[model samples]
Target: MRLNIHTLIHPTIQKLAYEIIYQKSHKKLQNTDNEKTLGMLIFYEILRKWLKIDNIYIKKVDVLKERRLSNQLDKYLIITNIIECYNILADVQRILPEPYLKHIDFNNINNSFYCNEKLQEYRIIIFEKFLKNYGIIEIINYLQKNNQINLNHVKIICLTCNSNILKYLANKYPQLNIYTIKIN
Candidate 1:
């Protein structure tokens, strides 16, 4: 399975996830079991709220079963949940068509600025498209920098909190090399 945290979240769920943790701890970024729990909860909430998927829960996933059996010794087991969720989403698409719904592939490029000289020209245009795709109007309440996205600013980079954005943009614009600095 692709070990990515991007496609696993949407902006609304992200706010809810953070709020779930914020109520428990003041420091938000502390990487602990609580943080992991919040992540799991967000995945569940996405299925429950966003997709109207109630019958399936995170506990039902086999990889999660393995993780629970092993007591989560390997943090990588978290990846299993995201993959399972994506599969669920794909199943939904096959069942009902949602307008403008972007099929997410976690492995796709999010937003990256390749310094390689050979890719410079292509990068310039792609970088611009990336900026537009993720500009303030798009992800303003999410990752858009302080209510303003300056494409003319030159130093354009995306540190995506969720990989779904990358997958959506890539699917929409296959020609442009979507770029992002992966956190993990």
Candidate 2:
């Protein structure tokens, strides 16, 4: 008779497995038990696949006393918890449908792309159109409001794979220095 053992595992053990996969870090198994090693190896494989990273090597470190296990586990859990939160935020951003909502104005920053104060030295603008007006209006408005963007100050506008958008932006923002390239 075959018995399903997974259901018998404690909830904390299940959470350990999740952390092992999501944390993408080496786990120290103190006891060197067969079951524990097997679980860690499985977790390593899952992490490798999820991250799309190859050439990962897992080494078994010397185990500490049983009393120290709790402290080590606490450290691991803390690190993994932070990493999991960041991963969740990234996943949410990827799955979100609103691009405009993701947009952040950088005009106020001194060293941001939208800052016009430093345009005279050398600057590059990468253009792409997806939502509306090719997003050039947003950039132009950023520059216009900042009082720094000018044709004489701009060095190049790199337009990849969209000449029409480049032309439109050039016509609309005549004072913008621009260039175009078709990436194939």
Candidate 3:
């Protein structure tokens, strides 16, 4: 089944929310020196539009009653979405680069180093979502089904934090030797 973009957008927003709030620490007014707020506002607006949430104006009194109240609300709405987006992006980031075991021509594996041009411009949100949901096994399966690789000879190197995923891969593809490295 095709992935829903709206489901993807929420997580992307959440990821950005963490980046903006925790990583950047916009608690102090000085942190707002750059266009960080503006960037966040734009992202919020995009998410609002995608989720079909109506825009509501916040009056000066409302803004004064709680400093950064708007930012806080945006953070809450986007956090879940950001987590989802990060997962997808991480997957794309993991596989899009050259020398993906399944994508490489095994005979020329030592020399081949090409990126998939078609996915080069994936939006950050979509890419993050892919990482969260699609693991090496799924990628290998996709390649095998698409005739990009022979499943019989495929070896999987999985660096995953999820033990359940490792167990699932072990059970599903016994023919393919799987080595997993623990990720914190």
TM for every model, in the order presented, reads 0.21, 0.28, 0.26
Query: Each candidate's lDDT (Cα)?
Result: 0.30, 0.32, 0.32
Total clashing pairs for each candidate: 9, 0, 20
For model 3, residues 108-164, the per-residue Cα lDDT tens digits are 333332334322222111111111233444444544454454343433322222445
lDDT of 1 by residue, 9-89 (tens): 456544544553354347444334444443344334433322332233256545543221221211110111233233222
- Candidate 2 lands at a TM-score of 0.28
Candidate ranking (TM-score, best to worst): 2, 3, 1
The better-scoring model by TM-score among 1 and 3 is 3
Model 2 off-target regions past 4 Å?
Answer: 1-133
